[model samples]
Target: MAIAGALIWAAVIGTLIYATRERRRVQSEHAAGLLILWGGAIIPALLLGLLLGYALWLMPDIRPWSAPGEPAGLRIEVEGEQFWWRVRYHPADGPPVDAANEIRLPVGERVEFTLTSSDVIHSFWIPVLGGKMDMIPGRTNRLTLRAAKTGTYRGPCTEFCGTSHALMAFSVVVMEPDAFRDWLADEARPSPGAGAPGGELFIANGCPACHTVRGTEATGAVGPDLSHVGSRETLAAGIMPVDVEAIASFISKPDAIKPGAQMPAFGMLPEADIAAIAAYLEGLK
Candidate 1:
């Protein structure tokens, strides 16, 4: 457009010069110059308008209501704690499966999320696939999203929750529907040879006073619910992997991993008790 405008301007100047030398009528020269100037200005304006319109059309429209054909059958609960996301998957007839720092969803299914906060305000965001929603205490917000394709999507806290908010992040795993079901089934099983021992220690060590595990005696809700801890990918508010070593480290020293974490350090536990507690949590699939 700029090039066209410049060419038209040059042509008008050249025509005026020629008309002056050849003694052409003033009206004819004036009409030609006006036509060129108007054309030059109008063309670019039209092109710019078209470009902006196209961009607006391409952007996704987020409505307060869910979109058509979007998955509504799958519901997940996400609880924000300090700087981490505690995820829970609702099964058809049983208790919800608990996880931290990672969320798993079936590919090609519309998944709805119920967002809440244990303490402060936080935001949940997955940039590549969906919008951001707030996790407010004593209130629940809903966000519905579907993965058209299968892959891992990274998300982070969109709100400034606390000192370690910068490190708050979670992953969305979109798997085949059948695979997701299998994973859930696996997570439902008690940890082989260690679940009972761990459950006993969890209560004896005072973990049950704050955390809750439905269908069990640990009914405390002061912290993130742990009914399905084994299913989670990471722990400590997304600070470490949900593995034996990471659980041990978090149980031993939480402040070291997350400075402002509300959970106190249990470093005084004997190495054997710590191992037993870690083993029990690992069984909460």
Candidate 2:
């Protein structure tokens, strides 16, 4: 498109220079009418029509949907919250795997995403994959994409949703098919830290009321799943590095770190208990 525009600009300049030449003859009314009719109107109309037609031809490839009665091989449901993301992976042959903040895909596989919002509107965007899709409250949207590369990419909330919109981002990890399958299988199981000392403290402090860690008694639905949070590349929806200190800081003062976050602050908790909980959560990986 840029090349086309530049070529048209050059043609216009060439014409202008020719018309303004000192030895140029004044064209007849008939010649002027023909120039206006073709160059001014018909040529531009043809160019725009061609561009529109080309875009229409590419729409299906860009946003292809599955055929009726044909289920997607892998469907991921992602719910957008005020300042975070809730992710659930549904494989064709396995149970749903709940995750948060980070998304993983296998190279060369077409994955379908079911997007929605819990509070306000948000836009799910991964520029390397394709265009952005909106996640609207009370409405579901589907976006299909295929990853051809193996690397880590970043996706952010393109639509302004709230105070922490800028902080709401996720990491996309594209891996080889075999590695992805192994990772997904491991992700489907309970966290390794489910029964550690920190896990006990996590339960004692009413953390289970909002978070869930499989293979243990900490099962709550108000917040993102922490079953494998330690395995994720980033913390707090990609705002902080995935480390014990970052986890402890967010746990102690979520509201201070992310304004408008729904999770209440736990800064008043004992420092030892907080550190233990962070260590336990980190061990989940």
Candidate 3:
């Protein structure tokens, strides 16, 4: 397209120079009318029409949505929150698995995603894998993606939904099919560290009212699931490292790290209790 535009510009300049140099000649009106009919209208119309057609031809490959009536074996539903992502995997042969902040996919397999927003508008975009799709409240959108290679990539909320929109992000881990299967199987199970001393403190501190740790008494659904938080690569929607200190710090004061976080600060808790809780969470894997 750039080359075509450059060629057209050169032709216009050449025509103008020729016309200026031949100003002494009395050109017929028929010649000017012909130039206007072809150069001004027909040529541009043809060029733009060809470009439009080429773009339309590439549309399917660019926005690779699932075809009608196609059977999608795996479906992932991602809900955009204020500053986090709620991910759920629905496998064809098993029950749905709930996760948060991170997405794991099998390379070479096409996966369809159902995206929506819980509060304001947000856009789901994994630039390495596919284009962005809007996630709006009370509306659902679908996008399909297939990773050709195994690697880790980052996805962000492209739309400005709230004060902490810049802090909202997620991780995409593409793995071999077998590895993805194994990982998903393990993710389906409950948290292994659900019986630790910190788990008791977590429940006692009213953490269960918002978060859920499978296999434990914490069954709240208002926030991200902590079933395998320690196993994930990052914390707080990929803003912090997944470690005891980060967890403790986030728990103590979420707003300090994420300005518009919905999770209230637990700074009043004893330092020892906070450390114990963070340790328990770190052992969730």
Candidate 4:
């Protein structure tokens, strides 16, 4: 795609350059003949037509979302929320695992990403990967990605969906097959109960009303899952690092850290209570 786009821009610029030169030059009768017209116009027309045709023909092979035996591979459902991402990993032989903000994938595996949106239109894009796909409400878009190397990559929303669009980002980690399998198993397992007021704080704060924490009483349907919040690489959809300080700042003044965030600030709480809440959330990993 990059090569094709560069070629197209070059053709346009070249046309403008030739036109400028013609305008400044002394035109003879021979310069305006049928042969000059053919060389200057018809030849370029035919070349552009062939170039576009070739690009179209290569599209199927470049992004084959429906490759054979794709069903046997890993399936992940990602929902673009107000300003975050809710991810579900479905392994080949186990129940789905819930996660948010961060994603993990195996190196050299063609994982099928089933994308959707909870509200408005969004776009999923990973620059190092292939292309971006639309995330439409009530509809699913599919994209396949196979990493050629093991590393961490960032993915940002290519579409402007809302006020906090700038902060709506996620991270992807590509690991070796064995490492990924182990991580997947660990992530898929249910989270252990945090016990006591730590659990109480999550509930008394009305967290369960919007988030879900496995192996606990907190079950909220409106926000992203908090079953493994501490394990994520970043918080507030990559706006801040996943640390106690960041979590505390987010809990106190969410919109300050991330403008236009949907989560309200907790400045009304005492400092000690806020620290306890942040500690509890950061200990989930």
Instruction: Assess candidate 1 and give its TM-score to the true structure.
Output: 0.71
Pairs in steric clash, model 2: none
For model 2, residues 61-109, the per-residue Cα lDDT tens digits are: 5575767897667889999998899999999998999988999999998
Q: Could you tell me which 10 consecutive residues in candidate 3 have the lowest summed lDDT? A: 58-67
Which ranges of candidate 3 are over 4 A from the true structure? 1-58, 61-70
CA deviation > 4 Å runs, candidate 2: 5-31, 68-71
Model 1 over residues 36-132: C-alpha lDDT tens digits? 6775677668867887886677444333355588544768889988867777789765667765678888887767788999889999998877879
The numbered model that scores best in TM-score is 2
Candidate 2: residue 122 Cα off by (Å): 1.6
Q: After superposing candidate 4, which stretches have Cα over 4 Å from the reference?
A: 1-58, 61-64, 67-71, 191-197
Clashing pairs in 3: none
lDDT of 4 at 249: 86
The better-scoring model by TM-score among 1 and 3 is: 3
lDDT of 3 by residue, 67-151 (tens): 7997756889999998999999999889999999999999999888899998999999999997899999999898888889999
Where is the poorest 10-residue window by lDDT in model 2? 58-67
- The best candidate in terms of lDDT: 3
